[model samples]
Target: MIDYLFRPQLLAVVFVVVLGLLYHRRQPKPSLPDLPWLNTKEGEWFTTLRARFRSTVNYKQSIHQAYDLYSKKNQSCIIGKLNGDEIVLPVSSINWIINQPESVLSADEPHKDVLQTDYTFVHPVVVDKPLHHETIRSELTRQLGALTMDIMDELGSAFDDIWGTNTTEWREICPFETLKLIIARTSNRVFVGLPLCRNKALLEHGIGFATAVPIASSLLKLFPDFLRPLAAVLIARPNRYHTKCFSRLVRPEIERRQKLLEGQNGDLEKKLGDPEPNDFLQWSIRRAQESPYPAERDPDIIAERLLAVNFAAIHTSTFSITNVIFDLVASNPSKKYLEQIREEASSIIAADNGVWTKSGLAKMYKTDSTLRESSRLGSFLGAGLMRQVVAPDGVTAPNGTFCPYGSCVAVPTSGVHNDPEHYPDAATYNPFRFSVERESSTAESPETENDKSNANITEEYIRKANLSFVSTSPTYHPFGHGRHACPGRFFAANELKLLLAYIVLNYEFEPLTERPESKWIGTSLVPPLTATVKVRRRKQNM
Candidate 1:
């Protein structure tokens, strides 16, 4: 019998049986590691895996459904195994991770590989050793305030020109095209300043830079880390294009300024600051001398940073603006919303001696509410406040469940924003929600008037609102959270508000389709591509 078992056929059969046993043993044995109170069945393991696969097809859709399940079950946390090694911790568990300090549960690990790709130009700057995060943050904060104030006239004028009453019929326009022009002009005005803003070749390069960098960065990300630097060099065309544009269009002006500074006495140069060193280039140059990465302070580097800002500003702003337009066109109720915003803008413009200031912008609370409402429903990100678990730690939710490291966690922003708990009858679009909250808060605490006012309408308010979703605190974050939250968001919010205000006040918009829903791919949510809207220029009563 022993001799027969050693035979080829017999050996083969025994080998197969042994392998099957080993494979079965290796298969993950799912357990309710977090649910100390409730016993979960073995079938739940398979259910979790199946759901994970389905959810992987489109994370946003799955997240929305997961929140609905969470709401119905009245559960703060749920646990599911994704494939063999991965796990799905409910939104609450993810929140716990976000709440923890950088020392305890670092975002550095999880997001390291996620953002290292070529598609993200700022990734290198962010991950580089010598570049201080605080320094960059401070500089950016100062730069944004100055930049926003400086470009108001140009931005306002661009709005007037693009949507001006000169055209009789509203031609079929590409929202992307219209938005690109606005973004390029606004960005150029701040980046290189005037004359270059009017440079046709430079503008074309700026527009193309937005599309190319993201594409290349995305491609670069898909490769291994060791290969990224090499890959960036390989995909150098966009960088080259940017360099060429900067060299040709911006370099001469910078050199002239440099010459002027060299010739002038210290006092005169300090007083004049190169006659007009008023844009991002000048700002970056001034700060770059103090930076460890002095090479990044170069005109090319300034161009790249400007390009990065544009990357952050353009698509997000356009998508948001387009969504608002879509929403206004689709909903019958939106006519009043549009009218309300127009009246607010008219009043503010009239009150401000025909000027739009930071204070004047604040008075358009209704418009702010409308945009906030639109973000609540039409937010494009699949998961808000996403973070990759870096440290070898676990997040224990309100239910005492722990989500381990290596897990990608996010706040169910769509869930929270649409949650009846937060916003009553959350599906309905209500512009008055924020405004009402502001009034109630003001009445309750008069001393907190400044707090309440700033809470509702400031750029910081919007940034905080978007970050709140991803934050452990759980307010409403459509953008993200923590130290790494979007820096260009202030500019994006103001740009969208101004553009929408301009349109609502001057044009009557009618959508060709009924309310259109957004389409989700993985974590990306894109609004309906081809919703036709008719625009009729409003007659000036004056």
Candidate 2:
């Protein structure tokens, strides 16, 4: 009875309506773009209320409906959201939108609003000063090559510890839970290094913090402007606890690094026996030392930044790999896809003398395609490239659609991903779609005489460039698009590929009867949380 009553879909609607009613009288009208609303009688209070209520439950449905009606015609449209309204631009406007200056269309602003960063993150400096992003975009990315072996080591240990070593019998394990554990430990190997990365309390609280932010944000959005501060305190209590837990775990490490930096005299090699740590904590401390604001160098703030990065890395990587695993198991009942992926990975690893290098991972085209296809089919968010209009006068699309200041604008990421025009048979999970195109593009023979012509060479080059999992564009943006796209995507792609490659080569999965259906709460697709996989270890380890 509790399960039936608290199902995500039902609970979302009930929660939205009840809270919305309480704040309805005091809430101000949302400033919107000059576009068609997915709802009817847009100005009528009761009608708008009903539409907003429907949207929480039918957000994906409305996305598709708007796509067919407006996006197909190359026009933008507005859709109701539980928090507010958003203007979803068509594929035609993506380039123009992303090219706009940050002052006009702010990328980070929307995230700050959605995550309720001021409250949930516990320090204004964490969001106000985004050096963490710089750490990821520069230091973390630069060190990925060096960190690969460490991640590989952690991945193996995590798998053995959580999945166990019984090779003879098939074991059933929950994919989501196990993958979350594997991702947290594996990612933290780069974030904080060993011992601390393996701490059970630290990991649990980190996961709790990741889970709490969204819940706290949702609850905070339910209150009127005047009551939000009080509401946020009550709603974000869990996040506060989690933050304290992270601070307790990481404070000692931060202090040790501070001392090392302070006494180094700009020459760390002079330390007789202490080797410089090659991890994110050390990198962040170095980065923060250069900041003009003193708070940016505070130990607690640094710990919060680590928590923020952990939240980003663990949550998204877990979702991505879990979807890939499920898609591989159930998308095709036949063994063909798995066999091909295994062959590609094994051949590449063998060619590299059994070392997993960045260049080596690049050559596993089939493995890359399988993950990309799953991303398209099972996207985590309905929209991408969401931004807030920050200029006082607002901004206008190239097509002359006007989005006023305070309006949230986004592109329908999943809509484009699912469009039949962009992807052939868009609904079916065809894992080899990109690889087949790749093989043909470089093949001696052509599918047709036209394919051999010089006219199509540019098209083939573009297609080849976009085939990698980290690449993003207007039509395919699971990692987002343009200059402001997710900075950690490159590291994430490498980690995911190594994990997938290892799984295919070392274990065998019992073919699932059907792909487990995912649940959609609001615009996010929650992968089958409790879905189980039957697996047996191969006699030889890859």
Q: With candidate 2 superimposed using the best TM-score fit, by how many Å does residue 334's alpha carbon deviate from the native? A: 2.6
Model 2 C-alpha lDDT per residue in residues 1-542, reported as the tens digit of each score: 11232346544544544565656676665467556777657467787667877877887888888778887778888888768788887778889888999999999899988888888888867887778998999888887778878988998899899987778999999999999999999888898997899999899888888988888787677666555666665567788888998899989989877876786574455663567888999888888888888878889999999899889988888888888888888855555788899899889989989888877876778888888988888889888889899998888787778889888888877788999999989988888888876756762323355876755557656668577688898889888789988999988988999999988888888989788988888888878889999988888778
Task: Itemize residue pairs with steric clashes in candidate 2.
Answer: none
Q: Look at candidate 1 and tell me the lDDT of residue 309.
A: 57
Model 2, 132: alpha-carbon shift in Å? Answer: 1.0
Clashing pairs in 1: 117-221, 118-217, 118-221, 119-217, 119-218, 466-477, 469-477
Maximum-lDDT candidate: 2
Off by over 4 Å in 1: 1-53, 70-96, 108-112, 118-123, 126-150, 213-275, 333-335, 392-405, 439-473, 511-513
Alpha-carbon lDDT of model 2: 0.82
Instruction: Single out the weakest 10-residue window by summed lDDT for candidate 1.
Output: 78-87
Cα distance off (Å), candidate 2, residue 493 = 0.4
Runs in model 2 lying further than 4 Å from the true structure: 1-30, 41-45, 272-274, 439-462
How does each model score on lDDT?
0.57, 0.82
lDDT of 1 by residue, 161-234 (tens): 66556446775555556756876787678667777776777777666656665455454544444445555554
Residue 61 displacement in candidate 2 (angstroms) = 0.9
